[model samples]
Target: MIRSSRLLNILLVSVLLPLAGLSQAAGWPRQVVTDNGTITLKSAPKRIVSTSVTLTGSLLAIDAPVIASGAGVPNSRFTDSQGFFSQWGAVAKQKHVQRLYIGEANAEMVAAQAPDLIVVSATGHDSALRLVNQLSSIAPVIVVNYDDKSWQQVVTLLGQATGHEDQAQTIIYQFDQRVTALKPALKLPPQPVSAFVWNGGGKEVNLWTADSAQGKLLQQLGFTLAPTPTQLATSHSMGQRKDIIQLSGEKMSEGLSGKSWLMFVADEDTVNQVNSDRFLQQTPAVKQGHVYPLGNDNFRLDYYSATHTLAILEKRFVH
Candidate 1:
């Protein structure tokens, strides 16, 4: 009787011990301190709501499903002009994102969704803080600031929060490898002064200097930026209007002369207008086909956006 009891006890302990170990391995920690704040994740968030463009892009990059998105702008509205959001839409569909937009987001709207986690970008705005606090009342809020850190760090932070740290790191590594391989193949010309012109119609063209995201991306691509004298003067002058003149047509061509020009036309009409303008047609870049027409949506500088741009450049420019 004693020997039979001993054998039964040994078998029960052997079977139960491994099951307990497995459970511990599968359960991730419930909370972590992020750059934004303390995040308390309850049972690996299954439903996520993303409010910022960067956060939404990151989530899609990792094949994570977003139950709700705050940026409700349709991809079609900007795709023809820029193509960034449209590419993201296809990826989002693949991830099964059923809920599209969170129109006029407020605490009430977020609370009603019952999300497992709410991800937002800290923009140093009072409204942003209010939204984060409101969302925290419903569930954990993880804030990420892409402007303050490297893209790899942003991805890793999101991965850690979502229980996919390993996947995020791998993606970052692969992105670095792609960049390294492409650098050698690039036959870049001498650094030329560049300007980004957006034809907003009615003879008003919006010109962006080195302060913009597109400008930063251009610099990364080895382009020199034009001097913004008005912007510089306004900083020193008292009660001076901080606005720069919007140049179009001949003025636009002249403002961007002496170097390759990149123009972002928002509407199809604007594109046709620029193509038909004799002054624009006579520019150096126009004659040489060096003028790159940026799609209306290509300005987003998130993880997916960067990756997509790399792929597009590789296909179009690199062999």
Candidate 2:
């Protein structure tokens, strides 16, 4: 027979095991539903890696522990030398978040980070969905769809995933408050404005539709978006995407047939170029002299850029 002390020790060990599991379940074993499917985290992640540069802003907004991030083209008007968006580049630097890679997603580079969690965008130039299986072996991965949702929605989803719901709420509330305070102070420009990233030469354009974050923000600020022509809307160069429609040739003029044009990813220089372009002289927006630049920073609508957009609009349109 077992010694009396040994028997008592075994009984004590069994009693504590269930309680330990219960304690773990209380704060952890969190589940988040993502585009890729449901992901279960055994515990709160300490190190997070973002494969989408665009998603990095939202992650940083909620104070997620992002150890590294995929980057975009370096030193562009929109991005810094490290390829982080200019809006949050300083914040990323302050947090010491390293750039995982630029241009393409590299599985080896990501693996080197040894992250507890990996984030990928469902669609965008920065997406790493092709390497999902490879990344899953390293850590739990979640795919977020940014095109269909507003920036606020993306932050809320990420907050839930990263266990920063309160931080997310605080940011959202602050942004909403600013938007609310500014809404009544401004006189909206021409109704039904067409917003797009002008392809510079007037040869092509990436038109922002109602579903895009930029479009939603404009609408929230009380500007009605002109409905895109049915024909141009159905047929486009870029494949079916909810965010932007790529148009060129005759479609460029026909698609931009709005009372006013608000060019995103543009600055005052872009406005000057559009004003002087001979080919676009007859366009309704040009003929009416209603073309306005929404600034280069308006290209992405993360929390920082979105707030900047509000300031730009308020200054331009406030009575």
Candidate 3:
């Protein structure tokens, strides 16, 4: 009786294993609806190439099989010599991610990588939309619009495309846990803060709106973004971007009317610059000594940079 029972259990295990594999297989050759259109992948991508430098960090965070990527301006405040963002450049180097190009998207270099998937941003300076026709011939191409989406949303989208949904879910859960724990420990600077990237000695400024990832993250941590004045709502001097409102010249003081100011992609030097600028010395934030530098890598929020941002904030506000 014991021998017969053992045989039955072994047969049952053999039958169930293949069914489990089949269940997971059924979802493949998946159809992902993107900004460009519908793209179908016959299998999970093994060699992925990201043309958008901003999107590369999220792809790496999820452990996607990114073999190569395009890069941005190199050796700047936020990037390395290869033009990879400071937050994820090390990871890219570790993974042996080849540089497809620096400032422009190159189809030939991308083709040499022999990627099974290619990701392009729908908007931004890093967009490869113009090269879509050429890249599509090399592999299945998907266009993602990161400007209007949060980093988590960007991860979720890339997760689906790269067949790493489990990794995507895990990272977001971890980030949410950190946010929850940090929320209670904070002593916020002030209510209704103004967040922006200030440059050119107060000549160029881009204000973050509630629609941006940085704005969303600040709001998640109990900070409020001051509303853009109605008269300034239509200002699009920097192009039609949903993430920021560009202001310059006489409009600088009118738009920067927050109780406190948080500068993104900045450090202590930037804060000093804001303080010393004669034109900006009278600004409410500068006058009250409420201006703070979030960090140099705070411009593009991804899992790596976002994590760094949380650390910076906790140290700044969590006395």
lDDT of 3 by residue, 143-214 (tens): 998777889889887887888877777788778779999999999887789999987777878888887899
Q: Give per-model TM-scores.
A: 0.66, 0.89, 0.90
Instruction: Rate residue 75 of model 1 by lDDT.
Output: 46
TM-score of structure candidate 1: 0.66
Per-residue lDDT of candidate 2, residues 1-319 (tens digit): 5799899997885454323322223357788889999888888788999999999999999899999999999998789999999989999999999998897999999899999999999887888889999999999999998877899889877877787776777788778778888988978777789999977466678888888998899888888898988887875433646888887776777787778888987888887877776667788788778998877766678998898888889988987
- Identify the superior model by TM-score, candidate 1 or candidate 3: 3
- In terms of lDDT, the best-performing candidate is 3
lDDT of 1 by residue, 1-319 (tens): 9999999997886445333322222456656566566666766778887766446767877656577665544444443222225547666656755443433456666666788888877642212445776678788888776544555667667776787665566666666667777766755543475545454442545555554445555556555766644533233112321222355555666665535555553334555666567667776766675655555544445566667666655664565
Error of 1 at 58 (Å): 1.1
Clashes of each: 5, 0, 0
lDDT scores of the candidates, listed in order = 0.58, 0.84, 0.87
**Whole-model lDDT, candidate 3?**
0.87
Lowest summed lDDT window (length 10), candidate 2 = 17-26
lDDT order of candidates, top first: 3, 2, 1
Residue ranges of candidate 2 with Cα displaced over 4 Å: 1-26, 235-238
Q: By how many angstroms RMSD does model 1 differ from the true structure?
A: 12.0
Candidate 2 local Cα displacement, residue 139, angstroms: 0.5
